[model samples]
Target: MAGKLNEKVLLTGRQVFWQDTLQRLFAKEGWDFYVLTKDFPAPEEVFRIHNVPVVLYVLDSQAEPKSWAPELNEILAMCREHGVRRFYLLESLEMPEARLELSEKIASAWRGGEMTVSFLRLPEVYGPGAAPEDGLAADWLEASQRGESRTGFMETEEKREFLYADDGAYAIFRTIARDFAGESLDIVTGQPVSAKELARTIGEVTGKPLSLSVSEASFGGRLPDSSLVRAEIGWSPRYSLKDGLAMAYEALQDEGESWQRSARRDRRINQLRGWKEKLVPYAENLAGALLMVIVAYFQGGTTVNPAVYFDLNFAYIGAMGILYGKGQSLIAMVFSSVILLGVLLRAGANAVALMYMPEHLLHFVAYLFVAVVTGYFADARAFERQSNEWHAEQARERYDFLRSLYDECVVVKDRLYRQIVNSDDSIGRLYRIIRSLDSVATENLFTQAAGVTTQVMGVEDIAVYVLSKDGYYLRQKVRKGRLAFQQPRSLRVEEHDYLKNLIAEKNVYVNRELVKDTPDLAAPILYQGEAIGVVELFGLDFNKWSLYHQNLFSITMRLISASMGRAYQYEAEAQDKRYYSGTRILREEAFREILQELMERRRLQGEMPLGILKVSREGRSCEELDSICGKVTRNEDFLGEHQGGIYILLPDADEKVCNMVMERLAREGVTAVREEKML
Candidate 1:
């Protein structure tokens, strides 16, 4: 359909449960929306169907990155090939660090390349098709309908932002309309709602009492700043949390009604089966008795010794006993006996005389013997048949239950297998990390460690310390965020013997003992099973301080350690290439690369200060100029020659420090100017 926006939008993902909502949202915004279903055609073929200018790849939170990342990369390549200008990645806020890592991996190749990729991070989304892990509103509504309590595996006090599916889709529409690109925008409400608050809201919406049981496990919430996106795109949620819950409750109510109708149909079928079982045996017994009565009436009603002549009746009794078991067969025997006595009375044989006669008594005894023996055996056979049927039913039920369990296990196995194969923290990610670190110089490993920790762990405050060769002290190499000013410059081994021993043993030392001045998390970078350096975190969210995060920290540190260890070995082999001959200053190319990385950090973090002092040679020799500048600059400074001028790169420096460095250089007969606007 042609609408306000002429460019078509293609929505695709690993799993697209909200396609309908998105379609509706796009329609309301007067844009053509085309959905690519499971049948993924060739990229060229897809373009033939709809020449779309924008592609929105919805990231499935339930799926492992490996399963979908390759496909996404292929699409990105296709977009670039076809001149698609705008591409959006819609992702969840759960495992934010993982999301960040995944986004980078997908967009790494296209950093400065074509086909701009933008990330739109969403909070927990709730709607009719929402899963339990994605949204709690649907779960609470269903529980309320069933009059049951839902168990939560997170702390009751933990609050998380929730967005409706329609609103989320609209956010995407707004981003496309506004042509937002080359930026990661978080689509959130900014206000986090707790479980208790949501539960109460659901109860109000459903008109049922809500009950929630919280466990010891805690969940971390990400408070993404969405103010910029809101201001830029002019978009906000149209529905409140309460209104969204009400709509979800209505959807659940419709589903419940459908389930009730199906249940009623099943109940009726079972009732018919019950009736067939009850009436079949009784009908057979009645027909057998009627046939026997008709035969006796025609054979001899007035004949003498009718009981003897009516011997066929005994056959009928045995057949009934075999067919209908003891109870029904006994009824048939009584009917036959009444018929025999009536015939004998009609033959003028007095009832008293007949009872006295030994022949008549023998007939009566014979009949009684036939009925009792057959009934007993028939009853036993019936019990055996019923026992077999009961066992079969039990076995069938057990088989169905086991089959269900097997299916569940298969699903879980496939999911776990994919995660192990392609997860952001899996072996593939580790390999990538090692490859990324392999290119870094050994002296810059600490800076790389801090950057990796921030991107992989989603924490800003980090510090890296290098162990001295004497093994008696640790000197801080780099510090980021507030940690730069919080911790000491150096730590003595003897002063923190407990922490030192733990680190030497290659174990992550958590601040569980509540040691004052200790970081929230600390781990050693091991080289050959010995501590070479330590990574410490001074600031961490209370919600994120869990065993899971601790384990993650440990694993990440080990990876960094491996990279550092490898870099150190390479550093020994490439010493001459890393620096100018006979000087501590780094080569120009090496210094520029490091500077570019620091500048990237400043752009991303928005706070790292960098100062560069440009010193003129004034017709002096290169070696003499280097010696004078090296003496005045600190060990942290980088001195490099660029365009026939010696430049000093001061990290973590302010305007005042840059001016001081300039003065020092001027006193050394080298006229230097502080480059206040360093890129």
Candidate 2:
């Protein structure tokens, strides 16, 4: 019967007679069940573990001593939801005329479809572990033990049926085996016993006089007929009332003896626990004080100076502060001061009055001051430790936000570094051209530009020139390959459509005729909108090129133009670089005029406002900063050195722009602070 079963049952109560009887009868059988007690898991978890198809809910109904327990409706509701049929055990179906609150709800739910329940009514069951307060058999036994002559309760001649615990348990097993669903049956012994006759029978068993005194208020009901229950279960009681009473009295005698031994053990344990609680605290403090004195004795002890122990005393104060807080630290400090004074008096004082030895008086005052200050700080330290827990929670929320920003910056830096290193990109082409002009020693500007352009552009030839220093005629610096020029020897700024377009529109022509049959790439090399030189590539097939690649290469020419301008200016002048005159940045006098021009234009045109930035470097290297300024500032803006600092005039920039410039300068070994101002 117990080998393997697809279905299981839940027996939800801890009553000794009913559950123990069922557990022993169903042992090694297919009717597997679980008994829920106080230590069992929560009700929802119990449903998940057992998954029983049937529930025998005994706690909320007749098993509990109260008329109705809270779990009665709750356990029934859970069984109904899981489609588990409920088998309810009871003492009787006949309710008193007045019903309790829980009983009223039980009647309502039974009428509705919320509860599917069957009843199995039992009689007054007597067995081991039955309380002396419940049932007439135990009550009579308690009177005989106390040497009372009689017990007062119940009508003297009122008769009630009796059933042994084992007989009632076997009847329940037979009823389940018969599969009696939703049937109510009174499973009793059908043997009546009078209340007075049960008291005399208990006296005979216990060898003590016992009798019953009739009370006016009593339960005089008779047990219901059990003819149908006997037929349905095919079972009958195995024990008569006289035999059951004799066995029950023997069990009560054994239980009274066992309680005497357990009470003695509990009393001894309580006595030991009471002593430990009163003495353990005093023992710990005494141990700590003794250890402090031992440490002081081992240190250097000079002659007749009690304050030699001051340093060691302070160490104890700090340790006590962190352990038990400020109040205990002050107490430790006071105790040590008293100990020091007592030792000094016992040794022999150097002087008794402050007038004789003023140094000794100052040491005593210093000792008191140290204790007061240390105690104040210890209190603050404890408060800070408590407050720091709240601040740590706030900082935890911002940690994730800061980490995301740091991760985003790392990805951007890697992408930018890769673009500058690849050879096929525009930034790569510009890097190569700058390296070529920076490394060469040729004085002529176009000679170096032609060599680098040929390598980077893969062109047949390149020719370069710039306007003469007086700004009148074009002066040819160098030429390579056979690039014919159709312009006059001294080209005027107003002559030729290509030169007019280069001056007016700042255009770079590619794969189009410049003079006549020269259809390649040619650009106007302008430095900050002034013509510096020219670079032309020959034999380029424009029909085979993407518009994007041509435009990207056109952008590379502008970057090359700025580098060529610096090379042209350096070639023309060989004088020493002054602070402002020969350097790339402007002088103060030039900056003043540019500022005036920008302010007037902003007032008239209603354009975006301008910002002035003052950058301080604190006299670190200005050479690195000058080069960065030449690259960072627009041609329309002004950069000047003033008072060991740099000034930048941003015409269409705001405070945010000033901060961006400060960040870029910081990367070039310059620590700059920008104070932005609006015009």
Candidate 3:
């Protein structure tokens, strides 16, 4: 709002109350904020045009909350594609008609380890600029001071939670200050007070007693459980309903009436959509200028002053502003100059007509004028494009430059790369060697060696273990034959003796039993101060396999190891997550594992056909569907979300029973595409 954030925070909300409050709070906190009233990040230009590191969406969908559901998916996809590392979405948990069990189920479905997408359901809001419907606490305070009772929104004995404006700001600060792993936190004070209790507390704080009024009998339970939120973020609001009501009373004593009087503007559609609206008129102008001129030319006007027919080129000049730097107006002006000159030099001109040719020179001058006007504005756009490219090139060069701390290893890499393609001036054969090694997968490392490579080298087997992403472990990715390893998956650097740090060269070990008359070659493959894998060779007759083959083997190792290292590095960064930023729904692998275990358990107990039902949300509320399943299904029924659907695996249950469950779920509130599969 004022200063800059540490990085840009994309705030997607149109409300003046909360957005304005957050802007004031985070302005001086070294965070730059950019608001997107519309959350679609299409054309990439909507988001890629900015350096947004994080997206914070404040969803105020109290009215037609379901309508915004589809937009959220689109916004999230765009955010993910643009490499937005994290998202923090805040909305209220309480829905007007949502039952306690149903709403909790929906919220739980939205929970999980997709750490990038977090939805924080804040407590009932009240502050300086609270909306009319949202000003419960503020309204209560005002009524208490005037000894009047306001009761339409309040139900007798109904419980609700409250957070002050300052506390809401504080909660927002803490939410963004730390990293959350796709967990929904309820920013509540953990205390739920009834309407009468709320009014009494405010009355005591305001020093004015309120006359109690309960016109009807109604029951409202306590607020939703937010203990999970408090535990996950390790944050607790300092304001209780009593304390917050007192703060709201004094600070918002006279402000409530004013805030309620303030008119609420309708949410704005993305104003950026207006940018392309110019294309329509620009296309029309081009067609209007060209189409009419072509018709005029065909109607035979070359001998006369074509200036009248070509006057539409001025319209083209105006259109140039829409497509600045495209040179459309310049091209038209140049072509018009040709036609105007042709008209002036016509031989059919008589004495009076010849005098008209000099005066008609003003038409040519007009062409030059249009060109200058269009070209001036067009050059501004061209300069901006060139300036952007220049800055980007400089940034790339600066970023790639290292300060001699770790770049010294690049020298070794360069030397090895040169050796692959530069072998004693016979570059063609060396180039072939590099290509063959690159194409050879680790699975075929030995098969290729036994082919044309066997004539040059006799290596029995090859195993590969690339460095893990954390840089502390090595994973055995691929191997041709039976590998000598005790670890099931991977080994840490300090776990294996041969896999220890071998930075300079391959540390070879002599094995006598590899051959009766020959020795085995075994060594830790080293690259960049870490042991990638231990390569071992058996039955290599040094007498037949000369030094040429030994050198070839070294070159092959260099190419293969570097490729493996690069691949492992990419995989670790892209796929490895400390925690997933999605709901606690099972992944495909986890679902399969659970299915197998359940099937096995059922088989041991007895024999039965396992019923597997896959339900696709199909543009419906996934959270609502999840709730229906939880409520209607049995405890033993396995329900997990996979591939954009809820998979319900019920052991010993047939299709008939599955249909019954589906019917019950539909009654509860899930409408989805269902398919039954037997396992």
- Model 3 TM-score relative to the real fold: 0.35
lDDT of 3 by residue, 1-679 (tens): 2553376777774364756778777776777777775423322444655747677766654646455555555566667655677777767646454532333344344334222666677766776656546756776676776678665334545777777777787777777767664556677777777767776787789898766655564434336677765766667777767776766676665664555555332112333446456565456545655654574476465523365644554555546533654466665566555554554455365545655676666766776677777677777778888999999989877767753524656654655554443433256554555454442123233223223232234332333445554556755433332322222345576654444534234644454344432225444545465555555454455553455555656665566566555544543463323112333245565566557655544433243456777765656554555566777665445666556556877655677877887787667655544454445
lDDT of each: 0.76, 0.59, 0.57
Q: Whole-model lDDT for model 2 versus the true structure?
A: 0.59
Which ten-residue region of model 1 has the weakest summed lDDT? 301-310
Question: On a 0 to 100 scale, what is the lDDT of residue 101 in model 1?
Answer: 82
Q: Write the per-residue lDDT of candidate 1 for residues 1-679, one digit (tens) a residue.
A: 3344455898877555567888887887778888776543445556544768888888777677777788788778778766677888887787557756876676756655447888888887888776555556666777898899877656557778888888887887888888887478888977678877877888889899797777766554788776876787888888899988888778877887898999999999999999888887778767776776677667755322366644876887788787777776677677667666776787788998998999877866766777777889999988998999999999999999999899878866865665575454677655655455654465567777877776566677888888877888887767777765578878897899655676667788878777878888888998888888888887787855888888888878888888887887786677688777777666777777768766755654456578988888788766787789878886657888665557888876888888888888888888888765657
Model 2: lDDT of residue 594? 52
Best TM-score goes to which candidate?
A: 1
Model with the higher TM-score, candidate 1 or 3: 1
| Every candidate's CA RMSD | 19.6, 37.1, 30.4
Over the stretch 1-679, how does candidate 2's per-residue lDDT look in tens digits?
2455544667774355546767667664567767766442556446644666666655333343353455666666666544564455444422342332345446336533434466666656776666754455666677787787554555556676767777876777776666666546778777776767666677777788785565665544547776777777778889887777778777777777778778888888888888776555345435555655665455433222255534565665556655555566666666666555544654576435433676755655555555566666877877897789778877876887788888777756655554455344456666666575562122223445656666556554455555655554554444455442332224565554565566557677655433564436667778767765555565554542456646754665665676666754664463233235446555555456456655553533244447677766556445655667767665445666654457877765677877787677666655566544434
Candidate 1 lDDT for residue 621: 69
- Report how far residue 446 has shifted in candidate 1, in Å: 62
The C-alpha local distance difference test score for the whole of candidate 1 amounts to 0.76
Reference-based lDDT, residue 287, model 1: 78
Worst 10 residues of 3 by lDDT: 446-455
Lowest lDDT sum, 10 consecutive residues, model 2, at 439-448
